[model samples]
Target: MTDQPPPQDQPPTPPVPPGNPQPQYGYPQAPPPPAPPQPGYGYPTAPQHPYAQQPGYGYPAQPVTVVAGSGGDTRRGENRTIALIILAAVVAIGLIIGSGVWYAGSSHGGGGTAGPGGGKNGTATVTGGKEKVPANPAADVLFKVPQPKTEDPSVPTAGSWLSGRVYAKSGIAEIIGYDPADGTKKWTLKFPGPVCAATERVTADGRTGIVYQPSMPTKTSRPGCTQVAAIDVRAGTELWSKSIGTGEFATQFRNVTVSGNTVAVGGSDGGAAWDIGTGKVLWQPKPGDGCSDAGYGGGPKLVAVRKCGTYGNRTLSIQNVDPTSGKVISEYKMGAGIEYAGIVSTDPLVVGADAGHSASGGSGVSDYFSIDNRTGRLLARIPVSGDAYEGECDTISQVEECKGVVAGDGKLYLATKERNEKKAHGSTNEVVAFDLATGKQTGQRAAAGDSFALFPLRMDGGNLIAYKKPPYDKGGQIVSVDGASFRSTTLMELPAAGADRDLQTDFQPGYSEYRYTQGKFFMAEPNVGKPIGSFDKDRNLFVAFGTRD
Candidate 1:
């Protein structure tokens, strides 16, 4: 079905086609706009633009021609060259302006672009929508010195913040009001006796603060007991003062805690809560023996750290006391073998700690520890060093002490102290942050800025860190490291050497001390005596004292 075509001999006419290829018509004659700022764009050798053949001052626009036969077909030669130049100029100008703006921002800094603190740069390039918190070299916004209005500053009470500001007893024995600004003397109320080191225990609520006077056990039928006093912050006055116990427990003071409108203190006999203003005993539970420190989860709930027996049988006595009616709504026991067995309360989840059991009794505990605030359940237990700080878990090893305090983040910061076995004469300080929910190390630990000791106090919540001051030093400062990474740019040299007694926290989460004042960094020296006073940190001021005489 295919037709055959005759084969033709090679024709010589093809040689004529090589001569003068007729001026290409309607062909792409223009090279790209100055070839752009691209990698491989340049005028081809011998040129593609028709202007390459033109002899002129500047390359003439490729000759545009019209072919009559084609009816105005373009001889497209460098036609778009002008357009390319203009476009590039516009882009160049835009880039130049942008670069100018960038340079200006970088040179002048202070446009709020870079915070003096925290972490930020000007241009940012790209940062999430976090405005970021800035820091100042000066903590002065929250720190002001209270000045003296009376006969020079006389009494330095351990200043504390309850519902409001309170300055506990000072030496020569007195409780006075120190201004939250300038450490000035606001008012003076004399107390009964000489306060001991960390002697004055205060329990604070949202609306009030209570101070307790602990009793030193005598060799009588009883050992010692504690007294209680409640102060109303808004009204600025002592609401009530009562002797909570008699016998040996007299002269003994328990942990005083206030939540909502009631204040509570505990003892070996039982624990009691009282009305905020009336001093009427709100709820008093009997047969609560060996009870030491106590606290309440806000509202009508109270939990006492009870030392149940002579052998370190600790118990979490959870009680619901009616602040309005002083009624015991509920009661329950949490565990046995509790040391310093108080409730680490944040509501719903109550974490507490205690010494499980002591074979004998010269008074030594496993370590300071904490429990679930609600269930009285055990959490991670870290080892504690001196009675200076609380200890925790030794279930697996004796080196476990719940030292570094945890904030509400369920992050427990534990500080471990041991007489460096390597250098028995020297000691080793370790602070580690652990996830309470998992009991695993967060892998972050803090030590001394210098070669010193780290004392950790209680933890708050998502924010804050706690640490301790080195003992035996003349004037030492206690550090509470709770912030994710708390770093103090400035730590002033302390003035005297005496134990920091009045420093404490209100037992809530994310709560910051505002560090307005400080207690004596170091306890008094053994042979040489130190100042006869203690200090307190109110809002932002240090309410302290010394004799004008």
Candidate 2:
């Protein structure tokens, strides 16, 4: 999950003037040695080795007098002793690194025993493989566990897998790794303060690392989310960190996101992009440029938005750029009324836009249109109306909101509110699919139960992952809807862990912090508003769902 970086307890750093660049920070190039396992986060503790308890004296130094032995023999004997000491030192160092690697990786859904460094030290005692999810969504149960929590439920939670463990940031100030086999703590990396923005990315080896900015709130007189850092997921090692000046209005930037080889920070005044492998600033657009703010689209493109013209007649330019060089590749312009315009898919060059307020008050509709990716010519348009288009249900209500438009499989799926006599919590809506090429309804509607609430999450295994929760239901249910047939099947039922009672005022389920990245899925609810004490332990419920092995 992400936001503008949070404020720090220390004083604010001055802003770096527009042209001057900030210094970059990076660690030595190594194959990133494994992360050292921390205590009590569901990782195995290091065991006490037998050699550690031995006396300092090595090999009980035997007295070898040069005078007592033959002259040539004495020199050779002394050389052999020195060589032996060096060999022992090398072996000892290897053992230490090996022990750290073992503790870091020993908890991947398999039983592990306490090893050399675990006993007396207050390190965490871990048992792995307890929690597991089926490889297929059609199976019995993926998994149900306590939700990992964050102080602010509004903040997004991002997930990744490292060393066969699930690493996620569910709470502020901490990024945790869980054993997906069963939801158990694998390891946790606690920041010095709360984190404002955090994101995780998996590399080729399946190892994931998180790039985050520590708590440096932007509301203060000296506003900035100055420090951006990356840590290894397996061992929490600070891979690299740097203070890139986010200017004054840092909160405008969205969560730190890693798309491909670049990790980007968004802001109204033109954000910055950095190479994920190295802490090098790849590019940053000058503020007031036609396209200032940017978000990642699929493939190698980035969507950039900027506003121009006078108050009476305003124009919004949405441009697609080459992320590696920040060069504008294609541009599309539309009038001011269209809001929330974003590129939803790459192959079809589809864009979604909504107009919350029209000339005659608010227009209760959201539009989706496809354009030629290269020429920016409008190809097709699809509009959805009803309560769903008005941003779903109510502003202050605790009901699950519907994600109106989702693009998948060369078609645009729109969730519209259906006028039905039965009214409960969640939307009784029909999801209609439109052919991307012609904008005509396919005449297929996804089967929705009487209690179906609308929230299309993402495209999973060629199916759209939808969310449903009936009034007074035990827990939310995740449905896998076939994009072609419009058939909906209940995949798994989310447990009612941190759900609030439906006592009118307290009924809105704020569990929107769930995420599906790569192949891993994790969702959790907020436990505590502010962490108590060490930020180590808090009773929270979270579940990790994945395909069965």
C-alpha TM-scores of all predictions: 0.48, 0.58
Worst 10 residues of 1 by lDDT: 91-100
- Please give, for residues 1-549, the per-residue lDDT of candidate 1 as tens digits: 012122222112111101011111123232322221211111101111111121101111111111111112111112211000000000000000000000111111111123224343322211211221222211121222332222212212232442234432233234445444334455654545322112122334424433433432223422222556665433446667766446443433323555566666543334456666687665553332233223344422444333233322222344433444433333334333232333443342333332322201111222223344443344544332222222322110111111234334555544443223342223435455545654444555454433234445443334332333333332233333323543321122222333322221211111112232232211210001122234322222232322111
Q: Predicted candidate 1: what Cα RMSD to the true structure? A: 36.9
lDDT string for model 2 (1-549, tens) is 001122212212222111111111111222322333322211111111111111000011111111111111100111111000000110010000000001111121111112222431122121211122223322122454433454432232333334445544445556676665565666776654344444333444333333334442233332334455555555545556655445443323333455556656543334566666677776653433332343444333444443332222223445555555555556555434332344555555666544333111011224455665565555666544332321221100010112345666766666544334233333354555667776666665553445444456656545676655443454455555655444454444434444321211121222234554433455553222333445324334344555333
TM-score of 1: 0.48
Task: Provide the clashing-pair count of each candidate structure.
Answer: 81, 35
The candidate maximizing TM-score is 2
